[model samples]
Target chain A: MSVILPGDDLGISTDQIETSIGPGIYKVPGIKDTKLIPINGGLLNIQRNKQGTRQAAHLESNSRRYIPQVSDMVIGTIVGVYAEYYKVLLQNFLSNVTLSVMAFPNATKKNRPNLRQGQCVYARVSSYIPDLETELECFDLSTGKDGGFGLLDESGYIFDVELNYARELLFNPGFLVLEKLSTKCMFEIAIGINGKIWLKCGDGVPIPGKSTDEDSDKMDVDYVKDLKTTLAAANYIKQCQKVSPEQFDKVLAASFKGL
Target chain B: MSSLEVHAGVLGNSDGSCLYVVNGNKVITSVVGPIEAKARQELPQTVSLEVVVRPVTGLSNSREKLLEEKIRNLLQNIIIGFKYPRQTIQVVVQFLIADGRPEYTALELNMAINSAFYALVDAGVAMYKSFVSTVVAVPPEQGSSLIFDPSMEQIVASKSHHVVTYSVEHDECKIILLESNGLFEMKELKNILDAAKIQCLTVHEDVQRDVIESKLQQDYIWKS
Candidate 1:
């Protein structure tokens, strides 16, 4: 993979036997009738498979804001609750979604879940009618179960990561942060496709020999300490793709004591 | 000419920003957009592009407005406006420390254009192609030589000055924006354009190299 700028030419028709275009790429009509000039700024990827060679370009420098699509699992805060719909502010989207009262699990006319202002919920985008409004459902489509989707009650650390990074954290089975952290301590995490990550760990239990238990406000202090450590670990894992393995452990240990 | 020093993402609050410094002239640019637009300034089919040029001292005058218009038009052609309809993309260029000479206005404009381009790229604005521009001054006498990237003193002594912008595509250079002052024959103007095109390539390459290098540094830090 090579980094490309706005005007860099990927390849002409001559060298490229087949052409497969991806996002962040534009084709400019060239003087030669058979050739089309492909140019864009971002990361250039050339893949060779049984079919043929495919070239793609993607903007890899910064995380782009996420746009909601159908079936996207999003973590949003309840902004307002109406008679029929709940205004949910999504993580990265400018426009909010309307989560119907009936969308909640086991909800009836008079037995709907009590959702208050500024409450966070994990919901799935059921319908995304462009230019109108997005609709959300709290139940999973496959099992018709809650699937851990609902109001989050526990206090934890929330990090706003890049959209791509969030996706990687959610889908990638070999994600280093989860693998390393799970080995050290037990934790739970909810990854939003729109870049919001919620992480909760032990209930205010201080690590042995790490801190003094004499502080009366040990719980709050421990939570803060755990939040900071989790953030640092997440950041390090996000940057792991660029760091060498030998240097990774050293840097991670330096940033996090008792890694 | 002194070495050009360019720094991207300088302004913390802006969506995209850059600081360009060359020959004692420093221009800081910030871009904010694809955001909500004002009723009067909103465009139905395309994004509303605004360019604001701030001088070193006092308020922006008509001269600055003229420069702003030039940049706005140039950006409209380069940026994919239709992608962000009914929104606004505001570009603000501030002269932190001007060279303090009247004749260097062309140079200032060149720097402003370059800085704006980098800021837009940083902001992740979809551009058709980035442009590079340069200023050259030619003497009053018919046979006098043309000066590339003329200083304040050279510009004051010269009779004609030209600021030309070139965008490269498929290894071919095409002029995208041209602003010239003073009188010159058709052949003389063509000569200046040719010279400016060559100079623009060097500047473009320098910028391209710096941008890639910086991106690599960021990738190294954030992605393994």
Candidate 2:
């Protein structure tokens, strides 16, 4: 059997295959359907398989496109609620992830979890809610063996960031700005991409775990105050990280957010 | 709407894995196995889901922790925690880029979950189904345009925007998660969701292509 070599060029040249396959020699013919796969190696084996080998060398470069599939596990935050579903943020406008009642077998029309704005949760890919406007069903828990829940009513710093700044900060990483307060330590944070960083550190506090806060009001002023310095340090570090190492050294001297 | 590219098994030795990108924003996710539970750990009838979100640049403030919890919740729901008791599946998502658009990065993270699903399969873990995530953003201005997946620039340029992450499982579109500013309305909400679904399909197409292409490549090389 002759092997057709794949090539980057539009057409495979006949002269490209300088070798041949025969009864004795190890050389294998590299042409198929008159097309050829480029021979980058020496001594090609031309053994034929029962099922014909599919010519797939013409595959295009890989695309990094993000798609939501049924039964896929995903992470998202509570953005809002529509009539029958919660409008969730999948990551960016590149995609929207929805969790509708239809997807949740156990979810009752009345007892379904109240998905609030700013809340976070995880669900499964139940199905694609079809329409001119399509969506992903995220409630069928039968595909996997585990069930997970998301965070609720947790407060953090929000920052307004420049695109370049956000990218730099993401690649480098730093902290959120914290402000000391008599009642509540405030965090003025700017998240990159529409960057705005606003936070409140309570009186000398350790960061709370995910389960600590069911309501934002539960956050005490003392906790905010305590976290002020840490948030400030973290924010400073993040901002500084966006700058080059050398640039950070120079900018730190004049940086005003820390103050 | 923006496009996302997601790759699974981008890293090594992780139980579940993925590399996801929304346009230019990048997020990599890796899941470690359902190993033996800690001696003191009590969940013997189920597996534990630990999610760590590595921000692009800054320390994960309360919000990031909250994000982790959000991820944990969804994963816990899907991972059949009790199936493998006293075990842990560690999901590590590293945000390579943010582009100022949280939704963009978030969408990448969602895609990473799908990739992670494959990685989990690659690691020999069984699951009920696979899922995908999409984001919808809407500007606050009364008459401003509704963006499906706005870049950081667009989100910031607008007064406010909403991001919603949804998925489909068992032939139904389920609301998996959501995050947004406090101020938003119904009209804008519907528009964002509508647009986002289109974006989701686009991403799904790409993912399918990539997976097929990868298998082809592997077969070509392994056979050689």
Candidate 3:
């Protein structure tokens, strides 16, 4: 991989290998011919696949804005309610997307889910055009179910991550940090393409075996213990972001030992 | 050549930031957005860019506003704003130490331009090219004499000055921005411009080396 600044030409003379341009790469007219130039500052990576060798420039830092695309699943906060649609602010996107009331599963004029302001929803982009309002749907057409979409009950912690990191977490479900953490605790996690993650831990309250005078006391103690564990797990997940992939499992194990 | 000290990602809250020090002058630049744009300021075909320059001493006035406008125009040429339409990119530059030469404001502006470019790169903003800016001082009486990256005394003695920014495309240097003041003959102006271009090329090489070194350092950390 070569480090390339903007306007640095990729001197590829041969056309023997199929050349594909990826993000940050642009084709500009040269004196003799068109040359491939990087339009951003980043490291240049040449990847070889069945199709052929393709060049891409990857930036070290992530952009603040996220561009919406069709079929992209995103986590958004409901910002407004209207007669026909709900206004949602998706993470990293400046424009607000609208989720039609009819898009919800079994939604009707009278039987609609009362989505209020400040409520979070996980939905998919049904239609999107640049400079136009994006349309979102809660029900997955193929499954005909919520498919992890719809209004989120306020039971989880929401946090922002780098867009690239969120994509990695989604595609690499077996990522070491997530794999190790899942072994120690049960968690419900939603990874949004726009770099938002919603996570919640299962209620671990222990049930009292028999009716005793100290049953209430035991229940209170158990509740506190469960809450502590849940909070700790969430913190651990957040800290795992700083650890390199190679050291992730080791660091996770060390943290658990300390706990 | 003056020594350059660059510290990237210096601000925790900014999307990307850098502290650039050249000689005794220091400038800090922070980049924020592709973010929400005000309705009035929003552009439909391209992202809006806002550059704010804060001087070391007093509040920003008309002079600072002019500098901000120049920096913003230069950046607009480099950044691929059309890639992020309906958004805004804001660059805030604070001069920590001014060189104390009013006539050499061109040099300060050049430094601010270079610093802002680095901050934008650090923020991962899409740009067409990376540019370097240099200022050349040409004596008023003696048209033959030209000084590159002049000191305050040299600038004060010189009659005219020029600040030129250049970016490399296909290994060829191209001038992107030019600002000149004071009286000078055409031939003398050409001489100063040529010298400034060379200086900018050298600056570009130095910046590229710094970027590569930082990337290598990051890779080392991950590998280790």
Candidate 4:
């Protein structure tokens, strides 16, 4: 499919009874409701509901900067600890979002979750009003449960990738980058829509204080190798998206060599 | 037509970056935004743009500021700023090479506008329509043909020069900005605008489309 640039006629009209627009598209504010145009440059996607009563259209685009969107899952690092919320940085140099102390799974003012500064948390953007500060929650709004949203362990290694690549890794079923990677080494990854990937390969980064015996020296060396291999793994995952899938085997082999 | 060339999404640090070379002018532009806006510059319901134009050797003065102001006027109209409230989109335009004299700004202005278009598209910023700009020079002699993207010598030799920009939407063009200098008659102004519009469309169809296509291809390389 050819990529669509801004101002190109989408050919899809907004005359439908009910049309729900997604990202990369916006109603030209201050204009009549008859026009719907794509604001971003990317592939145009228009879909119909099961009954065909409603239509949806969105543009699929990629960028380094991540704009907070409602319901977007993001991994952020706590930069400041506040009384009511925790200031988090999703990407460097962008605005900081707030994760409320009570946003955790079942908490009250008296029983607040005590999160400190410099901690990483995987949370969902609960509110994203452009005029107001963005808010994040650590629980699923449907069930009021953690729902895999909370502070992440320190053992995981986090790296950044393009937002589109992260979306592909999360949504595209045919992509085998992860599966091919699994055969070489075992790993766990948490992907955020904000172009961040938290990956843990092997035992993850080595903790130096875990061992206290004679084997401590050897264990430290082993963890160091794990760190090296982990670095190699991260580098491979970030770059493999550039080359076609057929050469993944050769590229992966080269990356892991001498580790 | 000095063989227009464009390289988009080349910078890693900025959100979007492009390098555009055409008609003896080379410009590099970077777009960083839909980001947080400072308190003083913030707007309640519109995204404010901060444009910076830096010259080749030294600091930028009034010459760059005027270009920045003109570009801002055009971009504010084309960009869907209301979609990004209380935010800022900053564009930094650096002229790497200028074939014209330091006193003349018509060529630099055209290059800046065109390069900014690519950078914004590369950054994924929302724009209502794509815009392309060109400079036209009318010679001092009568009945002489107009020059498309006139070189420094051509611009100085001509009696009048005009920079015209058109917003290309749905395969149609609309005049969005017109900056003219020197002397020209009303009839010649009409001719300059018509020629500039056609030139803008040609640039968009031939150079801009292919550059964006290659950018998308590189972005989605894993798919194939």
Per-residue lDDT of candidate 3, residues B75-178 (tens digit): 88888887778889899999998775554578679778888877887677878887888778886564366777777666777788788888876567888888
Interface RMSD of each: 3.8, 19.1, 3.2, 1.3
Please give, as one word, the docking class of candidate 3: medium
**Candidate 4: where is the Cα deviation over 4 Å?**
A208-218
For model 4, how big is the CA root-mean-square deviation? 2.1
Q: How well is candidate 3 docked (DockQ)?
A: 0.49
Per-residue accuracy of model 2 over B142-207 as CA lDDT, tens digit each: 676666656767656665555454454323445566666545678766766666666555554456
DockQ-wise, the better of 1 and 2 is 1
lDDT of 2 at A42: 15
**Model 3 segments beyond 4 Å from truth?**
A11-21, A27-36, A46-61, A106-111, A204-218, A249-259, B138-147, B182-185, B212-224
DockQ of each: 0.40, 0.01, 0.49, 0.76
**Where's the lowest-lDDT run of ten residues in candidate 4 chain A?**
A208-217
Q: Of 1 and 2, which scores higher on lDDT? A: 1
Q: Which candidate's TM-score is highest?
A: 4
Among the candidates, what TM-score does chain A have in each?
0.68, 0.36, 0.75, 0.90
**How much of the true A–B contact set does each candidate keep?**
0.21, 0.00, 0.50, 0.73
Residue-wise lDDT of candidate 4 within A50-120, one digit each (tens)?
A: 98789988988788889988999999999999788899999877778888898999899898887778778
User: For candidate 3, what TM-score does chain B get against the true chain B?
Assistant: 0.91
Q: Best candidate, lDDT-wise?
A: 4
